[model samples]
Target chain A: MNTPEPFLGATSHTPVRHHILSVLVENKAGVLARVAGLFARRGFNIYSLAVAPAETKARFSRITIVVDAESAPLEQIVEQLDKLVNVVAISDIAPKDALERELLLATIKTDVDNRTSLLDVVGNYGAAIVDVDAGSVTLMLAGTPAACDELERELESYTTLELHRTGRVALPRLGKAAVAADPD
Target chain B: MGGLFLYLTKRIIVQLTGAQALIKSLEMEGVEVIFGLPGGAILPVYDPLIDSSVRHVLVRHEQGAGHMAEGYALATGRPGVAMVTSGPGATNIVTPIGNAHMDSTPLVVITGQVSSAAIGTDAFQECDITGITMGITKHNFLVKSAHEIPRAVAAAFHIATTGRPGPVLVDVPKDIAQSMMEWWYPASIEELDLPGYHPVVDLDADRVAQAIELIRVAERPVLYVGGGTLKSHASAQLLAFAERTGMPVVTTLMARGAFPDSHAQHLGMPGMHGMYAAVTAIQKCDLLISLGARFDDRVTGKIPAFAPHAKVIHVDIDKAEFNKVRRADVAIRSNVAAVLEAWDANQASPQNLEVWWKEINAWRETYPLVYDEPAVEGLLRPQHVIESIAKAAAPGTIVTSGVGQHQMWASQFWKFEEPGTWINSGGAGTMGFGVPAAIGAKAGRPDRVVWCIDGDGCFQMTAQELVTARSEGIPIKVAILNNAYLGMVRQWQEMFYDERYSEVYLSPDLPDYVKWAESMGCVGLRATNIEEMHAAIATANTINDVPVVIDFRTDSSEKVFPMVAAGASNDDIMVHPLQREQS
Candidate 1:
């Protein structure tokens, strides 16, 4: 008689270090389910997850996952990622090589008619006014995933009825390129 | 004597480099033969292989080699190995690789990759084989250097065979394959921390005692076996427990051959297509002892109604599977053999529920599994086709099936006399798995009959397999239960979709699958009626040169009953002969 245990064994191990993994996956329905299922099945804690289309053609998507692990099982993660059928490749980029791993936020309508103070708050945060219609102004800001979230929290009091936020996206530093060695 | 010893030692060290070391590494890993296709990327390895003791069976297609390797591994309880070249050659094996991964079959797939220089440049015959196979395999490797080959091979074998067995791929660059290096077999595995690798073999004493007490106090108990039993090779331990407790046992589809069919205590498969007696027993029993079985939806029916009267005790090697669906009174995370051995030491006779057994026996007699009069009038019944195959299929024959009505019928009618005789994608429920799995099975056990049973829809999905089968000269018989439609979906729509027939009718006209088979250099036959079915079977049985597809059209309206509706629990089974539609 075999007894079943937790899919992810005992939770006794000390938390290693937090790892931020950016993934490029084929855009498809249930892709998230497949990825999430693998993490659940393997028993990995996902501190944060953000997703968006990587390419405008909608063929590829980017998923940013922040995991609390001492040493990430990168090989196993890549191995278990069968859910993303169209995933062409996966790589872990050094944090320093990230030029812009950030999210963009835009609030269309704000009660700047009565609260002119909201405009000052947006300006203080180095946010841009993308559109100004009637008495309200549309503010836009781009920053790191956490920084963008922080700025939004402070802007919540400005009657922020409509808000649009872009999930985390990143590009390698200008000089960095991955190339395979030439065949002799 | 000293001079000879020195000479031998020096020669052994020299032989450990280049292709010689590769052959020795494979031999050390216990790889007896390789099923593969040869190409430029892999010529160096094969050249050395020709001089080595290892055997290689050249297959027509790379995919066939993968299937053959998987089959050999399933048959021998060892990892099956397949080798191939880059690009199409490597990509062709993806389907079988996925098959092994889903079925938990141990397989080793070694592909020759393009030289490192052509890897990302997309040069002639170059492909990202490692990337392509990543998800389908449990693990994968790209041998960047010759020194890494032996260690990578060792690790691949270890991972592929340990814990939950699955396929692993190692793509060796062409240059690396030809390079010479000082080969030192990695003496031990580095402690790669796998979260789920719990090495403790003993069952928790407290849990075991609790379960024993529960069993002793229970009035009625039934034991359920699952695929894990066969996977762990724990049939003997399970049999001992059954005899000791006089417990009635049933199995899941993947666990079909776990118990002898003739055993008096056997209750048959339980779930959607389970036996009437088995379903009723699961529903009515006061205590359920499950061994190495996952409570898959097909088995549990509707969760709330499944085993409502019973206190479940689920035993499985996977910790996450325990109480994941059905809450168990006692759940143990240990190997089947280990737990059963532990239980044997602390054995106690349980109180007998004589009346319950009598009732179960009465149900079995009254609802004895019978077919619809053998379709003697005109039509071919799927049941008849299965029975005919079973009669023709030799003992220890390999039966693989694709999903749908035909799969269920084959599982029910085929009397598997031994473990590992039946193979299918049970958990994944993948259609088109039959023919390839059969290909794999035959490659493993060349002397045994490998029958591929599929529904018309399922057969058409991977019918391309005929090319591989014919070219490989593996005599696997393909039996198609053609009902002229998606029978399972049609049945569902008939019962639930208001009988609209919607798009379920596969009636644009079947493009002479027989001709299609012949075009692929394989034999094909059609069974329009009962008499012709016999003829088709005869034809299939006689052909030993190539794979044959026998298309047998049957009545589409027939439903696989004694089904416990999804989530309805085991007791609320809807038996065939319609007691009335679900309210």
Candidate 2:
């Protein structure tokens, strides 16, 4: 019998960087479940996913998926998603090539002494105080996902009551030259 | 003037209930037959089915309906349609749906759902079938309104039949089926707003040229054909390509009839339980030109050792298939037929293959498929029984087999000369697929002969479908290789687990299959010896008015040979003991 060699093709690989996939799909019922079900059954891991109506809200929905490339090949993920009937288009956005943002909302307990300091911290991060209760204050931050992560880390010192983050949503960044070329 | 205008408009306008519209859509799509069973949720749809041109074969079980549709699709090269009620009916058919999905058979399965008001209430007989089948089906639709019926049916048929064909499910709620709507049908697939489903049929010029260049230079090339060739109707193209290039061809289980077994350039099947010459040639070949065949684990045993020395050029319609398993040197996304047609084989130059052919012919001679006579008298070998049936059957007979050692024997012993003649559950390996699939094949092609080669274990799973065949007057022949054991599992236990047979032995005489057939209103025959088996097959062929069941009491000691043990390298193929001793 011939000695078997280690087969290094598509099957053998090292985990690469996480990929940001922007998928456009028909705004139809169960479309999100279809996409999620595909990832679950195929053993593809999703780092984070966000879906909402696209620019054409009446017809299409845009889904931003942060995929753990370590679990499955990106090509396979895209191809499988493309096979879904509701999916319209898919674009893989490199971190540098895209603008990504996440909305973070947190309600934190505040006393008389810490209230002034908390307001200062919120203002420094460009966060707005949405609601102010006697013992707590609700702060909202809409910024880059990295910025939100940093803010969350800094706020760990405070007593946070409730927190919610609308996972990251992204779109390809406009080229510098294209932006400059625009007449407006 | 107002009265006249109103009267003319009223005469021109026509409205139809969703059920009527669904049936009308099927008729417009030229659907000849449907394999289905009706229930409360689907009762409304059945009312219109009675007045429609389409014929509905009432199946004994929903699972039978699904397999029949698959069999019909495999034989006729068209999308087979099956309809069932909700909940249990939907769940039962999931197996066949998965089977069709894996094999890429075109099928449209329709199921009735509870009323829209009762969808999420966990109402009686209400199941989330669309959600359940979303992963298995190629695509699925849940119609919310009555007007969507025609469009949904059109889309289901279109998606199921196009690209890499697969099963598509359409779940219609009871209320929607009873609601009224304006009747309309999409004139063509283009009219349907399916912007997401543009299958890549056009070949890329650069890739095609690169593939041909590799084929031209390779010293030893093998055409690895799969089920996609049959789906795309590329058998003629495949034959021409193989002949022009002087390359040997090996057909996968799903592709048995895609290439003629009689051809000189053809090597038999490859992989586990594959022919010795075919498996060895693939392992040693310099170029593996894969045509529409996925590198399935069964075909590529121990992927690291499979076609170790070969540079692969994989062509398939589904882009997802490329690089999903084995990386292709040249991956072309297009219909197999289109790719074959694009590669003008007539322009190919002849190359030297004398050494390759010499080695392959030697292997073929040394490890030829053979079986010894039964050690015990009056017991027939299953392989011999399959061979006997193949010999007695007509040229264009469609053969289906249930999953087991018998399925492998049918694949090995039968000689398939035309495309779409061999139908079996290849990828899913679903048991009880044979009888229903044979009935479906016979129903689809009334003029042709259909035979189901089954194992006793598999036969018992869905033998009830014989009643459906008898009642419908679709005569299909079934030959049960009664080994009284789960033959393949037993073989595995014997070889791998040291013969600790666990729940494998199904008593031979329990619920005797011959009597079981007779009880189902069909002719039943039994054959204990080789001569009797042959005579039984001949007798079954003569009687075409009703389904015939032949219980061939085959030897349980016989095991399929040329097997590369599960997860073992294809290089270590074990041939039959008799062949090994002779060699």
Candidate 3:
């Protein structure tokens, strides 16, 4: 009654390495779940993921993913994803060839005496306040991933109430902007 | 063409219920027969099927339908279709789906789902069939709208039969099957253009040149052929390549019939329970040409020690198969047949391997697949039964089996003369696969003789399919080696676990298979001695209108030889070490 084992490659105890994979898939109902299911069932570690309509029309979507290659190799993962019915193409976007960004939002508790100090601190990181409350100031920062990380590291002393960051999204610089990201 | 497309979409006025549309589409797909059962969620589909030209055989168990479909595909090289209801029906077919996936059998399993509103509510017969079968299927779809049926069905067939074949599933909810829509099947081949699944058939000429160079220079080169040879229908090309290169060939168990067994360069199956000559060739070869085969752990014992001196050149359709197990010095990810077609070896360097051939022939003679029948009174061994049956089988016979000692014996003894003639549950090794799968093969090719070599423990698992075979007039022969125990595990206990056999033995003569066969509308025969064994086989061979079952009360002590212990290297193979050989 046992099922056949999914063929897995020999694992090694090497240094952790990150790999960026761009997957183009058809825009179907369970396409996202199917791609995610492969990772869950195979025990591949996913660092981050982002999905948007691909350069095509509603027929396709592009999924950008960050993975820990040390845990599972990118070749096996891409091949497995390629087995999916809706998947269109898989490309590994090298960091040097693509522009990547991350967005972070931080809500800091501020008092009247120290509110000016926090404003100066937030302004230094090129962040703008999105909302204001009685005791908190919510700031949003969108930039290169490193820039957002630098801002988050510097804003730690402001008695931060809460913080959230979109993991990352990337696009190739020279080719063209995506053809199907609908403008609202 | 654009105006016609618009006109056809606008002018279509005939509306049929989803079930009718499904039946029509299946008719258009040229489906002549379907193996399935009806239940709450699938009654709508069944209703229209009764009036359709396609014939439906109602299976007693969903699992039988699945394996039958698998056998059908193997026999005809066409996609096999099975339909079952949701929940338990779907789960029952999971094993067959996995079996097909592992063996690369092309199958389309259509399972019923709960109504769209009741899908997640745990309605009667509700189960997530698509979700459950994601990993096992090449692709799966849960069709929410009746309008999606035409394209989805076409896509399922396309995905199932192309680019490394595997089982695909389409879960149709009850609402969609009963819903009404204007439908017409897709006509053009252009609609099947799958961009992501572009199977690159063009091989790198440099890789082929390198492979040819390696073949020319190597002293000892062996060809390891797997089931994909049969799947790609590349046996002729493979034979040509082997003959041209003069390299000895070893076929894996799944690839038993890929090359003719009688060929001089052909070594028998290799792995645990593999022949001595084949295993030795694999271990000693300087260059191993792996063709359309994944290096399964069963084939490569302990991984690292397997073929230590061999530089592998792996050629397969799937890219991931490269370095999946053994690393390939040169990897060509293309169709094996296509690659072989592109290979032009005009330079003839005749390098003689007379010494190597002599060594292989010597090993074949010294450690042949042989066993001594007992001189003791009335004790018939399983080996004798298999040997007798093997001698009696006609050319181009299709032999199937359940997983156990009997499978290994059949594999060892049966000389398959043609490709696509030997079918078994190789990867999944599901115990009940024999009877149903043989029935499927018989149904697909009524002109050929099909034999299911089964063990007592394995026979009981799906023997009820004998009734189905009788009803369908498949006329498949069942030869049960009645050992009264799970012989493989018992042999393991005797060797590895100090002979403490736990729950491995069945009650002696408990089920009375002779009477069971009779009740199932089969002519039952019993063979207690060598004379009756021959007579029983002769009698079975004569019966053409009805199915036959012959129960041979084989010696329980007989074990399969040339055994490699699980996770043990081939060099540590043991031949009847733990047991005494009777005169």
Write candidate 3's Cα lDDT for A1-184 as tens digits: 4333222113212124766677888887788888888999878888888888887867899888877777676667777777676787777766556566677899999899889988886677667899998999999987666677677777777788899987778876666433321110
Per-residue CA lDDT of model 3 for B524-566, tens digit only, reads 9999888889999999998988889999988877788888888
Using lDDT as the measure, the top candidate is 2
Stretches of candidate 1 off by over 4 Å are A1-37, A40-45, A48-184, B1-11, B15-24, B38-63, B87-91, B117-136, B187-200, B463-473, B502-525, B535-549, B565-571, B578-583
What fraction of native interface contacts does model 2 preserve? 0.69
Q: Give the higher-TM-score candidate: 1 or 2.
A: 2
Scanning candidate 2 chain B in windows of ten residues, the lowest lDDT window is: B344-353
What is the fnat score of candidate 3? 0.53
Superposition error at B185 for model 1 (Å): 2.8
Docking class of 2: acceptable
Give the interface-residue alpha carbon RMSD of model 3: 6.4
Query: Model 3, which residues run further than 4 Å from truth?
Result: A1-16, A110-117, A150-161, A175-184, B1-14, B344-350, B374-378, B578-583
DockQ of the candidate models in sequence:
0.04, 0.35, 0.29
The candidate with the higher DockQ, 2 or 3, is 2
Evaluated at residue B244, the lDDT of candidate 3 is: 77
Evaluate residue B490 in candidate 3 and report its C-alpha lDDT on the 0 to 100 scale. Answer: 91
**Of the candidates shown, which would achieve the greatest DockQ relative to the real structure?**
2
* TM-score of candidate 1's A chain against the true A chain: 0.59
- Native contacts present in candidate 1, fraction: 0.00
Could you tell me the TM-score of chain A in candidate 2? 0.85
